[model samples]
Target: MRGVSLIILVIFFCGASSATAQFYQTTTAHVSFYSSAPVEDIEAVSTEGISVINADNGTISFKVKMRSFQFEKGLMQEHFNENYVESEIYPHATFKGEFLEKIDLQITGSQENTIKGTFTVHGVSKEREIPVILNVLDGGQRINLSANFQVACEAHKIKIPKILWKNIAEIIEVNVNADFQFISK
Candidate 1:
């Protein structure tokens, strides 16, 4: 009887470890952009972004459309879509990357890591390294990621008119906040 109980305990532990490796989650990630100038500051917000997060492996992927961004003023939004971003042509921006290898979330309480990935915008793709702060909660079952990065308008082929050059900055700062829930598949 003792030998049979020991064998059952070992089998249970092995199955538990394998089950922990396949956890996944999905969330509605929100992103916002802010432009600052000496005269005024403009802000735009977008919530129609989707994120697929793997809690067990700490991998994140997100997608957002250019048209989903909303600005404070309608005229500025129109100009942004028509002349600058050309949203009608290039519809979406995507990021695909994983955290630096071997930074396991199981051991770390809270981690500040860099996510290096390729970001595609306005039909242009560029390699960007974003500084991310992640909070591991509920024994690594929930993850909250926050980051801020600057995007150059010219790099993505966004052209600012001479009349509005001083109003809009050359680079825009983008902020992201995402919270994910665990999903078992």
Candidate 2:
């Protein structure tokens, strides 16, 4: 519930207005990560991500529960929560920022934009500028956003044991896909 509340607070902080607000939101944003290593490849996906975008001003926020990620192997999932990310201490990863380019809510096609913001993971926050491909759909009533980025585990203080160094990659690939529907404030 804290995650949900945080998203709501983000929306309100965007200065939503009752008469002219243009908020698009969803609780099912898709977020995934991949790690390629010499010994093994690791991947996980979480469809339980929450996001809110103020289309009027291009304000955006995204949050995903760390434990919500599902891995193919039970052991990998356990290690992810208990070892890598330490889900008990840092329960969620979040991004908050605004689009660098002005948003055109009426655009019928796709647009390339860059979002600069702070990405928090494993209790560490880093400023990032990520490129995104956004498609306006349903006559501007829906927006689909996709982005791919890389993160260094060491930068976030996620340590890899010496024995497991070969099993995990130093850098991880992250992918985000989210579809948000326009909702009136």
TM-score to true structure, per model: 0.80, 0.94
* Top-TM-score candidate index: 2
Per residue, candidate 1 scores C-alpha lDDT tens digits across 1-185 of 32343233223322343455544333356899999977678888887666655444545566777778898899878877888778899877777666674445575466888877778888899988888887777876677778999999899888877777678998999999887565553
Please give the CA lDDT of all the candidate structures: 0.71, 0.89
Our model 2 lands, by Cα RMSD against the true structure, at 1.7
- Per-residue lDDT tens digits for candidate 2, residues 2-43, read 555645755454654557768888788899999999999999
Q: Which ten-residue region of model 2 has the weakest summed lDDT?
A: 9-18
